[model samples]
Target: METVIVLSRLQFAFTVMFHYIFPPLTIGWGSFSPIWKRVTTSPENRSLPPLPSSG
Candidate 1:
């Protein structure tokens, strides 16, 4: 019984931590990545260096 309770609490803590941590990071990356890619891979910046977006 105690083992089950501990496992349940651990699962709950993991779920809560995952929910709290991932959403903001994913949202921020989703929003910023495209703009950063565009900036880095722009035609005007081509003379500067090769970017991942260009590849």
Candidate 2:
């Protein structure tokens, strides 16, 4: 029973940690791509209006 509990705790911790690492990297990379594209393709973006300030 103790061994089972320990293994379950380890599995849960590993899963939680692995799950936590993925989203920020995925979202960050996903978000960066569009900005990078805009920077590369749109010369006018350099002087265009700033993005609307979000609340």
Candidate 3:
């Protein structure tokens, strides 16, 4: 009974810690993946406007 209780506590702690750590990582990845893709795909897509034609 004592070992079972300790094991259950350990399992609970592991799951809680996993949840705490993994969600933020996945959420961060999801949030940043798009930006990462864009930046990586087109490094020089940012173009300047045409300059005025001075005589």
lDDT of 2 by residue, 1-55 (tens): 9999999999999999989998889999789767866775687666654444337
lDDT of 3 by residue, 1-55 (tens): 9999999999999999999999999999788767756665575855533333337
**Candidate 1 lDDT, 7-51, residue by residue in tens:** 999999999999999999999988987777777688787665433
RMSD of each: 3.3, 6.3, 13.2
TM-score to true structure, per model: 0.72, 0.61, 0.73
So what's the TM-score on candidate 3? 0.73
Descending-lDDT candidate ranking: 1, 2, 3
Which candidate should be chosen as best, given lDDT against the real structure?
1
Q: Could you tally the backbone clashes for each prediction?
A: 0, 0, 0
Clashes of 1: 0
